[model samples]
Target: MSWLRPQDVVEKALAASTADAQVTYVVESSEANLRWAGNSLTTNGSMRSRQVVVISFVDGGAGMATGTVARTGSPDVAELVAASEQAARDAGPAEDAVPLVAEPPPGAGEWDADAAETSIGVFTDVAPALAEAFGEARGREELLFGYAEHAMATTYLGTSTGLRLRHDQPAGRVELNGKSADMSRSVWAGVGTRDFADVSVADLAGEVARKLAWSRRRVELPAARYETLLPPSAISDLMIYAYWTMEARDADEGRNVYAKAGGGNRVGERLAALPLTLRSDPFAPGLEACPFQVVGGSSGSASVFDNGMATPAVDWISGGVLTNLIRPRAWALNTTAPATAAVDNLLLESPGATATQDEMVAATERGLLLTTLWYIREVDPQTLLLTGLTRDGVFLVEGGEVTGAVNNFRFNESPVDLLGRITEAGRTERTLPREWSDWFTRAAMPTVRVPDFNMSSVSPAS
Candidate 1:
């Protein structure tokens, strides 16, 4: 749907509303997805939907209701609005009431024509090449599996507060999992990008083949502390955990890693010893994200009392010191502190000379090279300790060379601790963390070398 139609529908909904009511209409339209397994395409489809959410404040009580309709179908905007207003009147008074305010949205010229106007033909044209790549790998006696997807979505958000926002996002991903014929070794390699032209099927296949070849011979290593070399993929996952733990309210409440020993939060504490910096910027090249975040909704669901809060470039960590934290609107109002939205994209900067992953490995005298991490779960929020398994590929490096592949091991570490012990920092690149790629796709990470990394135990699964 064009911008004009959604805007018109929103205007109509607002005009039909009574006093003390606010409404937001969000319309999303996109073409997406091609799933493949066992080296063959299995399913493909597209979707377009629009949802109208109403928030009503009657006599200090708040109520919210949402109605959705397919873009191809007729919708009853008036009926939906009435139902929401009635729900509000039936509800009780809210515990915390914060006034809703409108903020300026992105400029009209901010839309990317290439992203907004992407054609389904792009996927159709690429599927054949990907399939052929899979076939070629399978013929060489390797088991290959994964999925490819292309999506272009335009989100239109309009509120009664005179806030009108529109953003068009284009995303593509190619994930491949390859294993040896005997199932003794495996590796994961993929690409995530906003442009279809950047995904090279041949290069993806080659990467898997090369890793699988490296794992042809395996070595057994007992669980022990080793000097570890973490690639960008591994770094991305750890950084994601750090991002989620940046809640200011939780820290101030003394339930988070950022909490201080006595009273208050650790905003200015030196959490790491290295010259590390972490920040989020929606306008960052190759890692753009939505400029606004929706806040104050019901737990685990989109809130009827939602606010399209503008997100600013946040300097979360700088010069090894805790610089900032995420501040929700309600919490900010209660504490009289500044409000900022959590970021969808994360960027980690390494000071001084930047080395490539291969260069980092070459400089390592003895260490473990971790390709990816999986099943990550938080063990302790106070120390930011986490437990997870090294996956895809684990190699033993000796005398500045990868001697042989090693058994996978479970690890216990924290991103904060890792940063504090960083001996060297290497080149940074846009990476897709295996855990949060579905939601947080834009990340710029660097290869890092740590002096002592805890490898807890050997894992049976390869």
Candidate 2:
């Protein structure tokens, strides 16, 4: 693939723009992937791509208007700039318009550095470990299927206001599924990582093996409320959904669950009975993300006018109480609140939580254990009701032991409401959300127990 320095491209675009104000962003990315099925490696490859976007701001006498144009790979700086300016000229004034961010963050000094890259070598450790695990699975007449992916992206942001910044981000994930010889039973295990070094194929394989063994006996039970233990992966899925809807404007307008009865958002209201805290930090260890805003559009939670704005750590929910919401500079100005940029990573934790998932399972007398959740969709906006089906594996725990696997069930619950019902929360750890993996994968969560988790109906899914 043809290559151009992302930082240089950002500067060229900024210089080419004729609008009153302009912001240019370039993302140079590299990726590597490995897939295995039927206890053997099926595919392996690497790829490279770049995203170039130019946002132009114009003041058409009445007010400010913004336009955005994006292209893959190398984009002609002049054409991209002209197209963006034309779009701004054709549009009406924008309500979210604000001054372009001018202050340089800590990483801005590294703007001249080349983009970081990833290659097939990212799987050096993963490949051999997968091979050994596949052999073991084959000897046991089991089938192993899964994929491992790694990516590195360097983002460069430049603005007419004299801000130049760059960030290098690396992300990786691995998922493994084990099925019995006849495909009668299946189980899943997944891990989120910054690199493959910390991942252990043996540990993941062992978890899959144990779950499949528990499925040797099947139990059929009607759908009803039951004490349920949701693992970290499941918890991440629910919490991420809640995080995505944290637009301050939506709640203040009484359009979502965080809205107060009369007016304003529930900034001080407690959503969970336990003193849990849900936060996002760009500098979070092992889950670090870009520390500033880079945008080509405007939304309730963000604005193109605020491109290159510094993103500080924020606690949306602190000590169980709503603490903050995603508020761009424009929205913050409107609401008379401090601007809060949304970070890409999320973490949910509580004080004094130290029990592992196994310990939580061992302490349970009678409850359901969920392996994963899928097909999740929103049912209601006001109450934040979400519906989804359990998949891969669900087990019945009796007398502090897993007795047998149970039938899958469709569940209807609200992440907001579910928080208030949490009876126990285990230690926080990195996890992979099976449902939202395609869009969101950076999360750290804990296993949680709900005494009466609602199983809306019995699902025939296998």
Candidate 3:
């Protein structure tokens, strides 16, 4: 079906609206899939049978809820409305309760966004290509593994705020893993919705081969500080999570690191030295997302901007300073909320460099080239001191070349500290997968040269 009309039913429910009536409609459909070792492991597809409707009465302080049937089938709108009213009545009067602002009817095409439909064949055909690519490699490894997962969601939302929106999104992931000596080594994770056919198995196999070969030189860099480089994947994860803890509300309550005195939020603070800026453009070619949001404990789509205004581009960071902080619309209206920032998709920007990773290594004079980080944990929220293991590939770079692979190390460092210490950032920013939600984040990061990075402990898992 090109368009599933949940708004029509929502309007029907609204026609019987009373002076105290408040209503919201949300409809969603999703497809989820998983593949492993070039084989299908699980597939799940569902058109949400229950369309969620919530009605609240401000004067009576009563709320109710109900679930609807399938998209084309009869929906129990009345039951949902009654439930909402009952819910509101059940909750005793609250001094803080406010009436919901009524929204007008939506305009044409307000709830539509273009999206490509996907299917099982996407995984079925790509599985063998992945299997064949990894199988062709001749290595001493006992096992080889890989996985790809794709998910698509479509949400339609309408509210009394004269707001209406529909959003469609497709997210996907792919990764390679291999075991040789005695470790469960992992390759890079591919994130984003680039075509499945575009994943080069041969190229992927080569990366696996390099990691397998690095297994031979397992030397440890003794406990101390040294120059280091962080790939995009690690960078993205660090930044995304760091900001999460730095939320204004958390800061306001002394729950976060950047909280300021006198109920003021932190902005225009210089946090890092390495030139970095992050922004979200839903229309950005590779990173567009569904712009609307659902109300808290409510489903479907709310307007993009919190105050019924148009959605604004979000800047998580700019020139190494805290520029934008995400705040809810209500908060924005009452207070100077830093823009309400979610763990939104991040894009890294850097200038074209004069040299390559090889040249950077050659220029390093002496340093550690870290391929990936793992088992990350937070030690201090205030300082952002994070602990994690160096895994799969850790190499020692000397006089512009990888001298040898090094043993894994337990290290503690802050993203702010690391970015500040960067002496040389490669000209090219590479898009890499993040550790959390490995499927969605595409970190535009470059090889950074940092001096005096602390490598705290040694580990056998090289």
lDDT by residue (1-462, candidate 1, tens digit) is: 233455566677678878475645444456567777666777876665545454555554244332222223336767756766676666666533455557674532232222264545667656888778778877988877787766666655566777766776677777888887777788999777787677777877888888887787789999999999988778889988988888877788898888888967898888677778899987888777777754324431123344566677888999878898887666777667777677678988877747988888888889999889989999999989999999999998998888889999999999987888987888778777777788777788888888899999999868
Which lDDT tens digits does candidate 2 get at residues 79-169? 9999999999999999997787878865453878878999999888888999999988988889999999999988988899998888898
Q: Show where candidate 3 strays beyond 4 Å.
A: 1-27, 32-34, 38-81, 84-116, 139-142, 181-189, 252-254, 261-263, 297-310, 337-343, 352-359, 427-432, 438-442, 460-462
Report the C-alpha lDDT of model 3 over 1-462, residue by residue, as the tens digit: 123356666665566455254545554444445545422233434333335555555454243222222223454666656666666666555322333444432222355453345566566666566656555542354345656666555555555655555656666666666556355444443434544654565666667666666556656568888888766666666666675565555565554566665656567877667566666655556665545444433211121223122344576678777786656544445555533635335665555555566677777778787766777899987667899887667777767767667777888888766656766777544354545655454445566677887889887764
Best by lDDT: 2
Residue-pair clashes per candidate: 1, 0, 26
Using all chains and alpha carbons, the TM-scores for the candidates as numbered come to 0.88, 0.98, 0.79
Better of 1 and 2 by lDDT: 2
Which ranges of candidate 1 are over 4 A from the true structure?
1-4, 38-43, 61-75, 90-96, 106-119, 296-306
Q: lDDT for model 1, on a 0 to 1 scale?
A: 0.74
Query: In model 1, what is the error at residue 79, expressed in angstroms?
Result: 3.6
> Which residue pairs show backbone clashes in model 1?
297-303
RMSD of each: 3.7, 1.2, 5.2
